[model samples]
Target: MGRTRAVALVGMDAHVVEVEAHLAASVPGFTLVGLPDASLAEARDRVRAAMTSSGLGWPQRRITVNLSPAGLPKAGPGFDLAIAVATLAGAGVCDPESVAAQVHLGELGLDGRLRPVRGVLPAVVAAVQAGRHRVVVPAGNVDEARLVPGAQVAGAVSLAQVAAAHGAQVEVPAVDPVDPPRSPEDTPGGCDLTDVVGQATGRWALEVTAAGGHHLALIGPPGSGKTMLASRLPGLLPDLDDAAAVEVTAVHSIAGTLDPGTGLMRRPPFEAPHHTASAASVVGGGAGIPRPGAISRAHRGVLFLDEAPEFAPAVLQTLRQPLESGELRLHRAAGTARYPARVQLVLAANPCPCGNAVGKALDCTCTALARRRYLSRLSGPLLDRVDLQLDVLPATRAERRAGARESSAVVAHRVALARDRARARFQGTGWSTNSEAPGAWLRAHPPAGSAVRDLERALDRGLLTMRGADRVLRVAWTLADLAGAGRPEQDHVAQALALRSRTAGPT
Candidate 1:
């Protein structure tokens, strides 16, 4: 019997497991008797073929391979390299001690080639967290495997290459520092803040929302440039940091959305799934262990929902908890898996059943009751959580003739300055933005010149709930930061309240 190291996923976490292979005189068939799922059960034939094709001898006696901890379910072909190495060790073809210190992950091709597996980044991360110093992955995944700090990654093209390394007959190729994978750049946004010829109110709302990291909803008729406005939001956000990049990449990796051969994702992900998407697709749950859905994938970025009223209520309701908490936890019989969801939500919708109701040139064709019901899908609680609600107006002819507007680089610089101020203010609290400040923290450090007595009066009159009051103060803090004011002023407090109490606006 010989043992080798492998990894299996348990929720979002990867755990190391020992793959033991044994061969003895008996019937000349092989069996993988472990808690392996169907995919692992089918590894037997592939392993045999790969061994033979790699110029290694397959055991002609009874063979049994066990994956421990036998109670945990093992899935995927990632165990292929480990199983192959164990077989060679058990057959006295290689030293088990030499390969025992590393974790092995990769799928085997029938012709002795190694194929890359999904979730290599997470697997390598888990191995690193568990104190493993080395990892062997498919050559195709070498770039991802090298992302783990302090871990030596070896890339192999085929089973023979790995086996040869284990026998001390050849050197395992070291992973090269290849450029990380990145998201494909879509068509550049042609609209910008300066392109809108009018509706200064709506532009101000966008500025506040961007500065504060707040949720926003734009309501107006068709051709009001609501869609165009939402499309430009990524332009106004700050660049993602290293930690955020790893988190976003991890979510994409679990969703199988990571582009092959790409090593890092630098841009903040923007997910705009169609309105017809299922609740499971939006919130991240399916037949097996749930993977990250759209919300999680859009972490630290934008999640735009255009034509918002057309989406299912179930899909819309699933966002409530995550929107407030900045994280989503999928609960299942197996376990609870949490994914970060600190996204800047941008919802664009018309004011009524017929978008023409709010258009200047078109008369409403729908009943008032129908209009009310159409917008009612978003509950009052949900709207209250949204810090900015702008009534976008149609752009004037002058705006369209100006051609494509400001680039993302210009707006990103301003957002970064605001972010830096917020960071300095919230240092030691683990908050990067005013929108993320805890209620207690806001109460303890109320914005300077904010009338605490008046805020108390508003709370007493039911104008503001405890949560709402805290959020209002957070927005005031953001306004102060954006204006380069050391302390929040009275006008900033009033403007913050105006942005927060958006329900008072006309329909």
Candidate 2:
């Protein structure tokens, strides 16, 4: 008997899987057990061909490989290396003790090469968390595995190299290092805040959104630069910190969207899923284990939905949970996979179906009911969760032709500074951003005294729900942070009220 280890990704989390192999004298056959998904079950053929191609002999007796905790559902080919190594150990081809000490992650190609598997970062993270110090991965995934600190990672190209590294008397092969993926910042012709000709209010709202990690909605006529503002939001945001970058990278890794060359995703990610995306695609679900969707992909970043109202009502409504909780949970028969979805959602929609309801230049062709029905697609519940809902109009000729405005860099500087202030205030509170701060906590520590009079007035008039009032308080705190105020003043609360009022009615 030989035992080794691998990892099973349940969402972005990794669970260490024990792989045990046994050889018995019987009809030559290979049997893999322990509830593997289709992809993992096929590892038998892959491991056999890879071992043979690497000049390793397969045990001619009956072989049984079991992924124990036998009831746990395992998917993906990540277990291939572990299964192969354990089988080799069981056959006396390598030292079982050496195999047992290291965590193996990679898919085996029929030609003896190791192919990069998804979720390497999280798997390596799991290894470290589980107190396993060594992890073997494909050469292409070396950078990602190394991102996990304190782990001794060895990157190899083929099964033969992995075998030799595990104490087998086999020759090692040399492979060139793989290049990292290009950063979004390096991509030319990117959108910038300067490209947005006018709408000072819209730009300010974007800044506030970035500063507080708040969700926003932009309602306007077509060609009003709604998409432009949403697209450039990432530019105004700072790079992810070490911990956040690793978490974001781990999510991207599980989704198979992590660029090997990009290493850790320092820049805040930006995901703009078309309105046609399904609920599963937005919140994450599939045949086997649920995968991370657009929201999770946009974790710690922006998730922009262009033509927001055009999305299916179900899809639009599905965001409410994650918006409030900052985590998306997909429940399946297998289990629940929770992915961090602390995404700053930016939703854009036209003022009307024809998108000509706004601006005096364009005659209002849409009927009153037509306009109402269109905007109503964005349910009140969904709208309430959005912190900054602004009505964007076409830029005036004067504003468009005005001298160059402040660039994303300038706004980002202010945003970073404001974030620093917020971080300082939230030092021991466990809340990193105003949006993440609990309403109860904020209320208990009320921002000074009479500053919330305007909020009370709105609540009295039914203009704000408890949730809305909580959100207004959060926005007010953000405003104060941005202006470097000691606390939210009456003016800050008033400004926050006005911003929320913008999305209160149908145009």
What is candidate 2's lDDT per residue for 1-507, written digit by digit as tens?
889999888776678899999999999999999855877767888999989888887889999999988877786437899999999999989899999999898888888888888888888888899999899898888988998899899988889988987778876666553343332333122678877887888999999999998989998888888988888999989999999999999988887778767678898988888899999989888978898899999898889899999999999888889887889989887777889998898989998889988746267788889988998888664776888888888888888689978889999999999999999988998888999888787898676678777778889999989988899999999999999997899888888887876743221
What lDDT does candidate 2 reach at residue 206?
90
Return the clash pairs for model 2, or none.
180-261, 181-261, 181-262
Model 1 spans with C-alpha error above 4 angstroms = 55-57, 168-199, 260-262, 333-335, 359-362, 398-406, 448-464, 501-507
Model 1 has how many clashing residue pairs?
A: 5
Query: Candidate 1 lDDT, tens digit per residue, 1-507?
Result: 777888887546677888898988888878787654666766888899988877787888878888888876565327888998988888777788877777888888887788877677777888888888699988777877787678799988888888888883433443332222444444234545666555556666766677788888888888888877777777677767888888777777766677755566777777776799888878788654677778887888888888888889889989999887878888765556677888988888888877876645268888878888977787553676777776776766675465655554666676778889999988888877888888888877876644676677788999888977887788788778878988677777777777665432321
TM-score of each: 0.87, 0.93
Per-residue lDDT for 190 in model 1?
Answer: 54
Q: How many steric clashes between backbone atoms does each model show?
A: 5, 3
Cα lDDT over the full model 2? 0.85
Q: What is the lDDT of residue 245 in candidate 1?
A: 81
